[model samples]
Target: MLVRPHRSRAVTAAVAAGAAALVGFSSPTATAAPVPGTTVATTTTAVAAPVTAQADILDRVRAVPGVTKVTEATAPEGYRFFLIDFTQYRDQRHPKEGTFTQRLSLLHKSDDRPMVMYTSGYGLSTRASRSEPTQIVDGNQLSMEYRFFNTSIPTTPDWDEELTIWQAATDQHRIIEAFKSIYTENWLTTGGSKGGMTATYHRRFYPKDVSGTIPYVAPNDVVDGQDVYDEFLANVGNDASCRDALTAVQRRALGTDRQWFLDRLAQLTKEEKLTWTITGGMEQAFEAAVVDYYFAFWQYSLQSDCADVPDAATATNEQLWEHLDAVAGMSFYADQTLSNYVPYYYQAAYQMGSPEPYEDRIADLLKYPGFNTAESFVPSALRPVVDDTKAMPDVDRWVRLRSTEMLYVYGSNDPWSAEPFTCGREASAERRECYRFYVDGGNHGAKIAQLPAPERTFATQKVLEWAGLTDADPVAKKVKKNGRWSTNNQLDRPEIRGRALGRR
Candidate 1:
């Protein structure tokens, strides 16, 4: 860690005021190499590093181990943004092995402020924004893209070996190690869906890296080889009205109204200009989308109210397709999407558990008997070997017996909530520093802010107490783009996105 003193209250207050009052924080009288493509109107004062200009601070950042490249962007109102490229070993166990670069973005509000490590399941995003945890506390955020994602890939990748949870957690460990030297303060981590799992994995391997973590809607399969999610969807909300309604739609599309929907699928292919060869032609994509409908319904909370369901038997082809498309996007099976998410499916097939079959309700409707949704995505070239019983169960064991200061959030109706992480039946008796909250009928997009009173207040209070903060005001108000807005980089924050959907 860099050897420097913590900024005084006066200095921190001055720095937060504006660039003009950035007294010792900016290098007013020093000469340092300027950063390329970096126009830093203000620089963060890492508690231990020399106070430098925004650009020089980045220059210093480049010197941090694992940080290969840094470039700044115009940030949201009161924040500064930068995209970073960090080098990682193919396997953390052997540094002598080959290396790869993983990409991450930073949104800095101040140096002394607590920082939230935001984990993203996708690499396509280059946006700078605050997370639900960050916004609640109005803190800085370091959003890192998962390894093997589009923006961060090893040149000669081996999906089977390099993408282990331990290695990925180490990828995060390296980042935390490097950045702590600068922003030396309490650190917290958070992610939703797969990203939430990613955060929990890091906490498992390197528990002390962050003060607390909130993993949202993250499923923890027992690794007993059971696809519990199927059971969850089967009885979600314990209300069959909507499930029956959706199943009726599925049956009509795949059973009675099959040919017409097939025609619509072809027409959609032409109109949307999508390719299906990756998933084996247009007809195959149709089958996948149709099967995906029921799962997607609860996964995404497609029906806000059960009364909205159109009677499948009486609904027109257009109505069926609209409802089908909303729940299971027709384009979800597109060539590019399938190709981009190859890593996601690979992870699922490997250490992460893949979904098990629960299609007895529509067994006769399926033409492809053993069509594997995640398996099909793993190209023969990747040498896929699925083991649903490896990674998560161990993580669960750890969370049950060892994890502390961890908060879990979920939607009661979100399909992945089937196996939400738990702290065992003795949670209160054990005095564990862990919490679990499920929105009444929330979906994958559930957030603590959306939770009812005291539970939400308690969750926020715990996170605040963890970060040692008292409030979350003064945060740049998250806003939506009405076309005229300059950017739409907001990641699934509830206030900005109507739905808190995470990665597909």
Candidate 2:
């Protein structure tokens, strides 16, 4: 249960860098690994003659408008992967305003097969890999980079005007619409964390685009912060000792052991040959790291590890540093890490809300309370971007009243679970089409395969029906295998979601 997901290395690289968010059946053993490709011009090879199925797919990829480049990438058996570049607008409202090449990765099976479109929250690594939904549904996958991220940057960057959630969803709508002419079968959208939220936003704006959506650990966040996370942290690990031990570690690391932690940061930076570029110096970065530790401890660790966390005051520097590094990466706050995640911060500040810092828990320990760590990293000119309070609430309302064929998954230990998309409806009802499941001991990389076996079977069956692939071999093979899987995670059954606050 040790998930070393330090900023996913570079956004959610499709099943490949997912190589962070990519899933391989069970457990959160995913990380984003970088893949290389070029943005060359592309044109459609008209499908006048019906050739082999593989050849026809290439023609369809070319036929899709705005597709500038398509190059083959390594893939697992039975799948052909292509890295694509599509020239998209700075703002969908104004066609002539400008354009930038957005990254797209397609994993093809056949025209008649269902397709799963991944809504990534970060830059697209464009590598070939299937998400949880794609794997279970056994469908082709299309992974697109979010607008203004990595290679998808706007020609004229304007975070305030161009980087809104609606604009990003429109980018998705454009791609999905273009692909509709070829793949007439079922369609589904899925992603984890920020990517999961991206999928939900796409559904909110264009619900009918896909037959269903499966968002793992996605949050429909808003405004300054949500108190749900604070409560989660307070009770994380489901053991009072585990929760107290975590905060105690933070206190010692930031208080009496402050200098020791600083020295370790400097030494590790030099050892790794990395540079620091956070607004505040390494000290402030240290402070941020300690504060984020409350989350990292549970989001990345397991109940077993909680017993191993060194006593902040009693353990040797080596013991403390080992546990710290295991939970949080040393180079997470590095220059390149910040550069890649700057877009995430901008979106969080402008539209997608982030969890407020654990101020009540560690306010006095902080050296820079007024300075928002990630939000402050945004350019000074972009400061004072008003919170879009309506953004999340509108989606939440639509999800409850109008949303259908949607599924949500969360890990009870994941801090992001604090503010899950909450429209409490059951699947047993005829009208309700949404369902949520929690991985017993899962972390941020939770998967449906990890859900308590009964839930896992039910979820996959629902997913198969939704994708119109009812004939797929879900129950025929895995019934005996799932029975042996453990059900209990040794933690209190914390509620998976809370009332996502509006402006708290």
Candidate 3:
């Protein structure tokens, strides 16, 4: 069912003016009401702690895990480069103890080679702290660091106005501006998920920073983006086929106890279960498992409070995995944020307030206005404000930012498929000369790994080539439609290829 879209006059003006305020591009803040949930920085906290000297910044950055070295340069403008430890950021975000500050590492390489200034996706940590890696020519990795904005902003009119001011000041625009000051010349940039969204916005709002871009599974349509959020909710709303698929799994689990399921899985041979081949082998399986964990881990991770399986290990292993796939289409439990009805429930619920206004706006402005309609996928809680286009706009700005040189990748089975919905004609038409590849039976970003030896070499070589850097293979052929880009094996059928692309 579809709900009406809404726009907050105050929010619209605030965002527009806020965007304008970016590097003093547009007019100053308008007469619209001040944005809710923001606070101006008070003079009181000015002396919290002195920052490290500029000369020492690189040294501190190099110490982080995965960071091989840090380099500072004014080349390509004022930007610095750090060949980072991507593996490090992914692990550290889990956290064991102590307060952690988000950071990025800058790397250096031969100026003659094309460079990439990589940024990361959405998370509680700021860009400065996360160890985002930059893969340079000749297989060198550099990490980039940036700052964070953690001030709590009040969205409610009756809530604290000061906090909201704080958020508006340290808004995402400031984050981008701060990063821009570090680099001068054009470079290609990319990120996945939230990073993807940021990259999408960056390509449009700050085209000067990047020459071309890549956003893996970017949820550009954040307004209706999470329509597939909760499995329970999705089940209630799904059509018969979808409902039955999930119901089958539920019934299977009903009579079985958790321990019973675990024993069943333990008894299965590698060949019978096909778990080993699921991800090529056990070594690769570890990495794939982590990636798979992400879909639900976001909801339960330390950063947010959503839900926990409690006895996750105790759960019926095989049954649990099967159950996960069965109901996967229904759950939007991204790290416990919205999925769990919990202590932090108020925060998620509060975020819902921003979209409440959209529902009313959509009803008044569009043909399929009601929330109960078949076309409407708006969550019940979000139904009240479906029209708040101010919080989630149509992103026409994306058109101005599309690139022909871009390549998109996706796993066909990705849960986010229903929201961002990247594989559409509209997306294809929008970007000129863009190629989308579906990895047969591959998960998100899994195609490159699954490619046969030559294909893998070709794909890896293309990334280097795109960066204007050369490698040993220097693949000259385009990624062909037949999958047999090289003189190797015959490719699979289109449907098989597409289905294999995102089966994670």
Candidate 4:
């Protein structure tokens, strides 16, 4: 959901000025003044220039202690980008234990402009040049790569003691404090899926760090058995025919045509030059793919063009294979994909809850009925100790008691949406700032911009108003009618999409 800036300076300036006006800040006007010593000499001062904002913010960011590196990055037009690495403590409370250098990307629009902090729950592949939330808020963007993901891993890792959600939230707090020294404006935090979950966790731990939070498709808690996911699968799509068609496809792939699909999968594996670290080998991986197919079908392909799964009885091998590969391919469950998700699994197993796969529907067709656990999806080498519930209890309490000025967007059809944060009846009556919008018949790809008419307009206005931006009602009206809000096309690819089973 990263955006590349290609805006003209005139547009950037106008937007910045408008944002300032909305937030009750008046931009200083540049005017020439006569010098005191010289009768004819004069000097002009430009207030809030983009160049000054960039230089001042960069200098201040570099000066933050533990910042090991700051390299200039090529960014979209009208913006300055930098890749930064900061030495952070593995245990922030006990700073003497050890340290790890975490990576973050800073996309500076202006020092006086509002800031959008995108919390990436996993390793960031690239600096999200632009994102839906950033566009709606129209501010400076900071994309943080979660610790232990990508190049942010610790020197001597202690997963049991260090990879807690509180530690991750602490990392975000430190970054926000450092950057607040320069930006000095209202800050908004956001992320999608796990990233969205990270945003919620940060707000729970450090509520005052940011002005508002907008978490997209973020689940609040992970149930040990993931019964909610089972409930979600029981009812996902809008049409019964579509759901039945999907069920038929699942049955065909895992039942009558099981061997054929497996052979085709093997051939596809060879053709694609795939490899995996899965313990159950190709057959096991195939089973996982079968299980994944059900989730992926509803999560991504529930759209019109993809939902009409062909009748399995009349479908050719090629047709089935094409649909299967496109929907839930072996590459998704391959070793490479599994390897990158060890940190997520650790978090899920230890503190963050995981959802269990719904096997009752297709149990008769499953090759390994016992493969219901999420642990099967993780690489065996990086097994997690599932005894600790870390910060789940605290986060739960915070959401129930203190969460405010928060906007949560979720899709009605998304499995993750099943466990959205629910405000208690008393809180719902008392809390006006907190809102959750469930897009009707929407899937995982849903965003505030993509929501239909009045809802879309309502969400836009709410978020902008929450971010302290002025003219939100007017802008929301225009954007809603014209479809101007940024859309989130990049979807999360978690190794285990649903709840993890077999909790010890």
Candidate 5:
């Protein structure tokens, strides 16, 4: 899953403030030679080196083919970091036809340590320096920004010709091949949400590239009709009162007090300066936010929060608006936010099927009925010409039949868990090493460390064993409390939630 920042002014202000604090933690900058046909941005710094000659690593990386720019930066205390841009093919099979340069971040700890390749499903800004898989395993980290995201956009985006899953996997493969020449150690690949799905697709296309993969909260094929998510919503969480309260909140937002909420939404749009290209205008965005409230509640929050929901009849407008803004923020469907996700929408509509919203349940509440399709999330210019002939049944078949040595983690309460890959359970005894874990009561933030007892041990052991780092146990070191695993220390662990539904 992609991890996108909430683009509200509040979030932007917070980011700007935090950037200043990060400046002091960074290492001396080192500028790299520029690559041809690209706008280059470099930061030069100085730092210490050991007998291993860390100083020369930059020069060696620059010598690699297709490497356009390499800049040294500060990394987590134990590692050194560099940002690199490489020239890649728009189509690997027909490379001569065209090319695009993509960006990647390399966090080096030691040459002989294990390596974790994190594949992001969307364009990644330079602000993000680490990934969840990188934190779980003791290894060097390489984070590849997916094609058409942030800095990875093709010179001339031909969505029809350039945005294929195979092409994305190939982009990861070339980076792996190039970096292996230097790292030359055990390699593991992982991602969450769409990124997790991307990692699986990479494994499907090139099983030999990485020894193992851990796709967190990764769903399999998207069941186009809302049937999958509908079943999930009906059964999510452990309390009926909380579920009913959530439904009540949605009804109030869209039904009896809708105009009041719409007036508040309009006032917030002006105060927060929110803007969207949603075809139905502010009213549609308001409706979408109501639909999103149900989704966001389970996706990122604890079920216990639902108990705090007020009854529609007795609740004040401030109470309802406060809960809505906190969970399903208005910024989610803004024009700028939607624009940032055009590439993802195209891919979902074309080859990667997306889950349809449960409109039947909210049919009467919708301002613009039938506005729940994938086409509704994107701008009019990029609406995909959905073709039924090109679904991903073959990919599904391969995952179930041949994918091995993989670990899939999910949350019982997470809606996406409704359509998890069933292959691990269906595979023969010989492929039992391919494990699927569902964290009891966990949400999208569920990780192997959150699991209880033997399950946590088993999940952690499998990943370490696969990465050839059996001696290092992040779960045991961090999660064990009084001889049992605990997830209370979530703030310290790697974040598992990917980009909200939009990127995934």
Candidate 6:
């Protein structure tokens, strides 16, 4: 019923050591005027375009077939938004790298104000430049994890805890550089879900580049509670009985009923009023399984101990760890490879079927990569960093930097929100150094805030205030009916579905 959803830093001149090595590659600049015709791939580079003509070029492109939304505006004196297009190659190593084009909007709010960059996370299905590009807010929540899922270099060793941490940090630095190159100033950054966690990472890494940040509905305790897969197995069985049945199936499959488990799935699809096909059904089950497994995996990774369960004893950290490890073994991604499910599944369901071949592919991926996880839709050249736990020092340092100026918003109804046992409130006072917005009955950043007009008004007002756009109280004139955040903005009217999530 209620909708749920869901940075940094800089480098030195290396003491002016080696400019050749320092400047690996530079992106072609944009121009105000359109270039004639479609430019084909070529060995010779295209000349840089002028910024003055960027709007005209965009207008011409908008008129082309299949072209979507095109917008051009001189961002206010302090803030500016620009849309750039570039063909992204998944594998820098591959001669024929698949093409990827993305739009980045920059807001340089004034020198006094901070530059705030929003990362897409609500599953943006369309490019940022599309006519009907997804809105910034989805399901009343702002995405905070775009850098990890969308913007960052995809090269990462998925299973190597240390490497993932390292690559994440490296990507974090690159993200800051990207921002600085475009905006030429320090900024505040945020997003939701993927964006949220990224916000955590950003604060964890590039603290100096950002004045503040807001991580909405993001879970930061990835070392423990961020397990979506295994946790789902333990919870989303439709009910306790369903969970029990699934657990039984998992146990049986481990023993003698593997074929039976597969057969039952087919039977359910054919006989029951099942909306999902065998493939789809398996996907769902796998997702739930992954969530649960990840939880156990965290225990093992963090505690560095296996779980043990007696015949009559309840599940322990050890048993779950073993069970999850088994699942990891079965899944090709368990090997040190890239992160995220999309690319891994892409290879499994499409390129390679056998787990062994897939493992080899993953190993190859470790050599050099671009923007892809273990299994990539496109090959990359950037080497995969396997053990990056050393980056933790940088992460913790950055986290402290942004904590002072950041605001973290979370929904109680969201499964990913961090809720500690010691503090029952949305967030503890100790954690409140950074403002944390807790929406009652809200899931992710959905339309729930609209139920009451006062809340809606407050949200709008707060956003504007945060942006340093206006000082007018959106709901100052409205009487406080019950002292709860209320709003008259129709956008907040609970009846309407506020926003939908997208894949960026």
Residue 434 in candidate 1, Cα distance off native in Å: 1.2
Name model 6 segments beyond 4 Å from true.
1-49, 53-116, 120-124, 127-188, 208-211, 222-261, 264-402, 419-433, 444-462, 472-504
The 0-to-1 C-alpha lDDT of every candidate, in the order given, reads: 0.67, 0.66, 0.31, 0.64, 0.67, 0.33
| Per-residue lDDT of model 6, residues 85-122, tens digit only | 32333332331433223333333222333345555332
lDDT of 2 by residue, 1-504 (tens): 001124422223332232111111111321111111212333433335434435656766765666666777777667778888776777778766656667788988777778899865765654466676776666788888877655466534667788887998998988888777667888899887777888888989988888889988876664446546667777777688877888887777778778888888888778766555534466666666666666776775677878787887688877877766555544565554554555676667767777766656677887887454446655444566677778877887777777788888988887777777775555446776887888876777678888877888888777777888654444323533453222222211322221111111
Question: What range of 10 consecutive residues in model 4 has the weakest lDDT sum?
Answer: 1-10
lDDT of 3 by residue, 158-190 (tens): 112111212221233333343333333335666
RMSD of each: 11.7, 8.1, 16.7, 12.1, 6.1, 14.9
Question: Candidate 2 local accuracy as lDDT?
Answer: 0.66
- Candidate 5: list runs displaced more than 4 Å: 1-55, 125-130, 278-280, 388-391, 424-428, 470-503
Per-prediction TM-score:
0.81, 0.82, 0.42, 0.80, 0.84, 0.43
lDDT of 5 by residue, 334-414 (tens): 654455556666677677776666555567777676564556765565555464434466677767777887888999988
Residue pairs clashing, model 2: 16-19, 17-20, 17-32, 17-33, 19-31, 20-31, 20-32
Residue 265 alpha-carbon offset, candidate 4, angstroms:
3.0
Pairwise TM-score winner, candidates 1 and 5: 5
| Worst-scoring 10-residue span by lDDT in model 5 | 19-28
- Candidate with the greatest TM-score versus the true structure: 5
TM-score (C-alpha, index-matched) for candidate 4: 0.80
Is 1 or 2 the stronger prediction by lDDT?
Answer: 1
In candidate 6 the C-alpha lDDT for residue 331 amounts to 27
The parts of candidate 2 lying over 4 Å away from their true place are 1-5, 8-56, 269-278, 359-361, 370-373, 425-428, 472-504
Question: At residue 471, what lDDT does model 1 achieve?
Answer: 34
- Displacement of the residue 5 alpha carbon in candidate 4, Å: 29
